[model samples]
Target: MSKKKTAMPKITLIVLLSISAVLLILLGIWLVGELKDSFSDPADGTEPGAISTSVSGGDEVVMLVNSYIADMRKDKTLTIEADGVSVKLDLNEAGAPVDYDELESYMKSKGYDTALIGQYKTVLEAQGEPGSVYNDEYITKKIDELAVNVDTGSDTEYELIEGGVTFYRGSERTVFDKAALADSVKAALDAHRYDTITVSTTKEAPEIPDLDELYTMIYCEPADAYYDVDENKNTIVVDHVVGYDIDIELIRKELTEGTWTEKTFMKQEILPEVTAETLPQKYFKDLLGQQITYYNTAEKNRTVNVGLATAAVNENIILPGQTFSFNRVVGERTAQKGYLPATVFQNGGMQEGLGGGICQVTSTIYAAALKAELDQVSRYVHAYKVSYIDLGMDATVYWGSLDYVFRNNTEEPIKIVSSAKNGTLTISIYGKETRPANRTIKFRSVVLETYMQEMKFEEDLTLAPGAEKKIRSGMPGYKVELYKQIYVDGVLQNEVKINTSKYSAYNGLTKVGPKPVVTDPPVTEPPVTEPPVTTPPETDSPVASGTTGEDVPVVETTSAPDPNSPGI
Candidate 1:
């Protein structure tokens, strides 16, 4: 309060001091920013305030990266050089190994912006040089060049060899350098990518022919020695020869010398392994097991299928310790092979499908095999119960997946005699029956659990009024166990457990009346009425007659006058 006289001087001094302080702060900030800009490195995404004394500027560096990207993006061609010829393959075709998206992503990660990317693509398309993308065409051309024709056939006229069969034999060609060709192609492709390429001109013959078809063609099947009970004759049929097969591996070895020589007549005669003299007395002479399968005769197609399958298995021989696959023996089931469409169980329901009735033949054979004491290799039970055979003893087979397999466990080879007649499928196993004559084998199924089907009702409009019809009668499901029981001299010797099978329940189906029932009114009957009584005219009691004591009206001479007579 005492210094009020000099207030204006004090205000001017404070204003000047404030302005100078602001100016100094601003100058310090400018100096700091300039120093940071000068020392910043372009590699760290920091722009420099001034160019460096050495090294290219940012624009030049960007131009270099774009050029590299353009070089990588150029259209590539795969050139396969071999046999003094260059095979130019366009890389834009199928099977090419380029990834444009991946390259673009990699370029972007290296700080390539959209403008630079577009500019690089333009330059890449403008370039005339083709990038390299080597592949396998070189091997193919070289292999063709080194290929040589071979004549391994004889000039002898075609003759039906002892087996009464003939097939044409022709010259065969081979490539000697097959292995080297593959290696060379691989090496060439690698060498284009800076790897060493190896090439060769030596030729190798092609692999030997498959002999399975030839063996089957040349094989002469021997007739099985069967006993004919009707004639009481043990028909001992003479065995025949299964002639001639060439050793494919041996031929390949002989041909490896690279000489195109005519094949030598390398033939080997095959003799029947089983004959009447070689047949075991106990094998194929006595019946080991027999089983019969019954089917509905109304299923004509299914019956035919069963017959076909039976014929396929008829007289089939199983060598000792050899496994028999049902699918392999019967082959594929198709309409072309004489199988027909019939109802089969599939996917938890009964459906009409191909190869339906073959299961009957399989089940019959399974029963016979069980009785023969053959070892079971693989078997599957049906999802639902089959009426043709007992529960747990039935076998169902499907091609490719499900198969009925069994091995002949006996020392003697076994034979199967199958026949289908009048909807009856019978399978018999004949082998050396070593068991005691009094001993018998039987298969019995034991029921463990039974499932009663519940009735299911549904409305159906196709039925008569107030009618209820059963569409399907439910079959009771069962859990059964099969047992192989053996008896010797009329006494139970032992019981062997075979398998446990569970069958799913099928519900009973019923069709009921669709609409509510309509009833008629009660009928009314009329009451009984008797006819009215009628009284005769009153007649005076006639005086008592003298003799009869009866009143009788005396009739005048009742002869009516004729018309011709005059009325009086």
Candidate 2:
């Protein structure tokens, strides 16, 4: 039984070995077949990444594609029609056709099929490009051909207009649509790439200007130069002006030819009528009149008032035919104006008041005007005679009530200059002398009548027995006639009666003791020693101090004749 079992085991082992060999053989064959399929050479033996277009079809197909594209690119010229205007584009130059390599690439990418031709046709229809190309240099050259020489109507620059533009292109005298032409030109340029074509414009231009407005702008009125006096600077400033006029025809032609610019007008300069060289320098040169008056400088307030008025009148100019007003020129005299109260003729007697001495200024100016032969516009005489001026020559001025006015009737202007010094008031008028030099003028006064003032006495209780004192002094009155005597070569030519004056008398009074009183001999008081008086330097006139002391004199006198006194 053991031997039989052992033999069975051996047989099983052999069967297993046989099955293993068959599986080994099949695995080898299958592996060899896979290797053969993996390493085999491709059809036509071309390298990788290489393009091959060889096919069963002949070169006719490739040639057909090339010819079709070329024909489409170079078949005929492109025509741009807008508003009946036609423009042609040329495409025969180099780099003007489609690129062959580019076309091949497009065809390959899309693949060969019956629809490929239809695809090309679709591109043509969509693009609407006759040349189907873009050549910048060629297109610019063609554009140059359309340029036209246009007259700019300017001598300075010669300009030309570009682009083929016509008011009537196809139809006879038809209104062309400029907007459509511009739009079509731009579209054609964008849609097609031409080899040599250029678009330009040319048309008649019109320019018009408002002649009236131009005239207003170019014309200028001639002005006269004049002097402007700066009072503060004490200088005469000259104002200069210039005038201009335009050439009308030159500007008109320039505007019509569309060449008018800012520099186109021709201007003419006009000189000023008055120039600095011809300006007046001196209005008054010669001395025409002069006069002097006397004043009591001891009256300090009166002297100061006179000085103020004189200063106001000094350096005053009166133009030809201009009137001089004393009140207006002197202004109002008040305490604010530096005036003090002094003796003035009021109600036929001397009264103390403000601006009492200003009348002296008016009197002095009046006499000076008379000597100069100035026209007297208005004058007022005082009711009573004054000690400072002649009876007929004195002129009194009051604010708002009275005024002294005189006019410069001479052909030349006149100026007034005044000064008060050494108890004398002098007024001089300067102007071009028109009167004859040989003629001399002087004033003459004739006393018509004289009357003495009545004296009266008054009782005084303050004085001792039988003692008397003069309270007021009396002055004599007189009526006088003034005349102006004109002489030529010391021979009297004419004597005309000018004015008549009447002076009123002033009353005088004396204070006297009313009754004598009996009294015993009084004891004698010690003698008081008085200060020694020094003798003053001898002068022709007696000068009194301005103090109102009891010893001061009422009237001051000078050795020189009192020019302001009556009948001077």
Candidate 3:
């Protein structure tokens, strides 16, 4: 019995010990779980091994990293220096020169975990931190700013004076290597320090302007002198310009050897074919042809228009192979240009219109040009026969529609001179005469057919009874053939028909008084004596008469006159 009681006590003690050991194992597991929970990130539920050291959130890590960056940049200065150039940068400004990777390594040295450094970078990215301060753009900008102090003098300048061109020299310049300076600055910044970086430079000579381009800009071909109308409607001579040429090889040699002077580049002058001094004498030395026409001096408006048109055409020059346009030279006639209304032909009748008498001027010029042997480009005769010029010889012109054109067929320029004095208007053409002096030309008109004018009579209420009044006088129409007879030394060379012209006939208008009223004598009763028998009288020898005995009164009848007669 004593042995059994002792075994039971020992068994009880063993059971209690087993229970404490099991509880101790379970408590150890619970404590480990608590410690893991305390160290892990609660938001992501990450394990303790993945936890950051001390700095838990992204904001905290960023704060730590930014503080370190600020401390490292405090009161520091970075400068990019070169020959005669220096550019200083503020280290404390925003865009702190430290890179994110360098900052991460710095943070690691400060006992911050790699994961925490990653979180710092994430936070910086979210907040738009670590901006492009030391990038290519920044480097270029800083270098350009530094280059302003290094003055490379102005480039070569050229001036064209009188006969030649002159060039001025430029000074040398120094330039810095932007890439090398940028690398040095970034390396210093990445090392978390500031220092003066010396940028290497290169010396460059001043560039010369392209000689070929300069030569082209200053070269030109010689031009002949010519005549042109001035603003005041006066003919003036335009002087020719002298051309020049330079030897590019000589200029290049002088420039290369640094021996060029203000007059180092020489040019040769080129002469023009026609000089200004002798052009007028050569072109207008002889009188080619002339024409004179007479106008009624009493017609003041028509006279004035003729004179104005003459003035517009006088002293004008037509170059060789160039055409002269009458309407273009004498522009549209208006009251503002001092033109007056005068008689003009319209629709087979005469009416008052502006520029009425200018056609006379055109006709006069046409005749003069024909005598001068100029080629006619365009010409139109009048609608009806004009008294100022013969049929088939008059040239008509209207604004914008009609023009009389002629070309200078000679090899030299021709000039026109005109004048209007009293009742005489004269136009003369002067040019280098190429025709034989003995040759003479004349134009003649021959009537081919004639048309008689017709007369029409109408009753008028204003004229006296038994009286007549004449309105417009009728004009006879004719078809005429014009011939140009060429005579050499008073001998006919050839006779050629130039043109055939037809003039329209106009009917004469006349107003006549109405016929006078007449009353027949009252018929008297023949005494009521109708009882006497009347015997038909017969004459011997067969007398041809309707009445017999006592010579009955004879009544005579005549036919009406033809109205188309000239005396109608």
Candidate 4:
């Protein structure tokens, strides 16, 4: 304390104030690591200390982030889109685009981790350019990975949808036929190998030239058929006349399907639409204005099983999404197929069977297909009313639950010819021969509402009250209502909804009796004791308890009503 005076020596002012306060605390720790490397990685665009890049900086900062990811992937392309379809990241070839500002100039000269090496510098920015990568990892490299980018199409322009079915027709010569032939739209390929960079659609479909022997056996030879864009529906076959015969058996049993479409294809041309100048006023007014008839009381022997009103036809034509089937061409009516019995509807009434009364031949071909408006493909509903037709405009079939189907769906092709003996069933659906006769349907029956008859009790018979029989009267049930009235040439045009026929309520079976057939208490004869007459007491000696040698009248037996026993 007393001699510490040497302390005043002050070795050069304390070594220049301790080296200037250790260089001001190492320049404030190098200015706080240069402001923490400019805020760690303000998106790694470099500029801070100019060196220590955080990806732990190794391989010379992986060679300056692989030379700015090779000028940011040289010929880039990118593109990308969603829902409405679009895609193009063509990573190579003349395909490029993902430079995004040279990925921020190589995430700022990669002091290594511009986000863990920016996923190896976005595949060195998807390689078409940027190099110095180890030795071509698929022509480029650098690992440090982390992936999950979906939205496919990085390989090149993409497209994939595939669903279709279209059929168009609006002719005098084309309106929108559309499918010239990208293989006419039937794609189902899967050759695989990543679509080998996609490119396989040469497209073709030619064969459709027989236009009835290529234009009537080369008649003028100039009868063209050309169809380019490769050819399928772009169909350009110029012309071919007369080709008819419809009734597609429900289109060969619903859609000319397969097992190889079961035999059916043929083309014709005989009078296409009856042109020899309209075939004599179509036989003087559709064959003398058909008078409609079919009266065949089962040819004498009677009993139903007839195809009687054989085959007859004045005409028939249909064309518009066209299709009308009925066992193809009404082919099964037999007497060995000659067809001739008449009258039908068996079982629940008018008994006869083997096509009895052919539904009066399907109700006279359904009131000539509803006076030629024709189109009722599979009808059925005739439990009773079979006086030819009429009744919600009659249409019946039992084969497949009612069927009279129809379809001109219409623009042309229609013609049906029919005719049958003594009485009638004339059908004449001809078409396009000046196109007149506007329409005339008329059925009109009106309020035929009559129900209440589900009694189904079978036999509760106890008859004879007023003794006046006939409870199920004449079995002539009648509750009819038919309305379709649509006349355009004769005026009155408008009345639709045509279907309401139910005549199944006929209850009349007279002969009613006196009621109470069995109330349980009626056989009273149990007290007739003729058996104890002095009893057999004096039996032996007298032996005649009221004279009994042969008078065995003990009368005491009656017990027959107990069917299963239980009656209060």
lDDT for each candidate structure: 0.63, 0.63, 0.74, 0.42
* TM-score leader: 3
Better of 1 and 3 by lDDT: 3
Per-prediction TM-score? 0.44, 0.48, 0.52, 0.21
User: Which pairs of residues have clashing backbones in candidate 1?
Assistant: 175-204, 176-203, 176-204, 177-203, 177-204, 282-432, 283-432
lDDT of 1 at 151: 22
Question: Can you write out model 1's per-residue Cα lDDT over 1-568, one digit (the tens) per residue?
Answer: 3644657888999999999999999999999876455334434454443322223343453356445544554555444333333344333331233344655686677765434444333334444322334445654553444342222323312233553433333343332455664565545433333232323333333344444654465544545443221232212234444445555455445545535434443456555565555655536887888899787667777777888999998987777777778998899998898898877778765667887788888888999999888999999887777777778887889898999999988886788999998767799999888888999878889999999877788887776545677666666789999999899988899999999999877666777666644455455565876645876565664443335444433222333222111110
| Candidate 3 lDDT score at position 365 | 94
Task: State candidate 2's TM-score.
Answer: 0.48
In model 3, which range of ten residues has the least summed lDDT? 559-568
Provide C-alpha RMSD values for all models, in order.
Answer: 26.8, 23.0, 14.3, 27.5
- Candidate 4, residue 298: Cα displacement in angstroms equals 24
lDDT of 2 at 153: 30
Tens-digit lDDT string for candidate 2 (365-396) = 98888888888889887765677666678788
Clashes of each: 7, 7, 0, 67
Q: Give the higher-lDDT candidate: 1 or 4.
A: 1
Model 4 residue 417 distance off true place after TM-score fit, in angstroms: 7.9
What are the runs in model 4 whose C-alpha is more than 4 Å off?
A: 1-349, 371-383, 386-392, 395-414, 417-430, 433-445, 448-476, 479-484, 487-505, 508-568
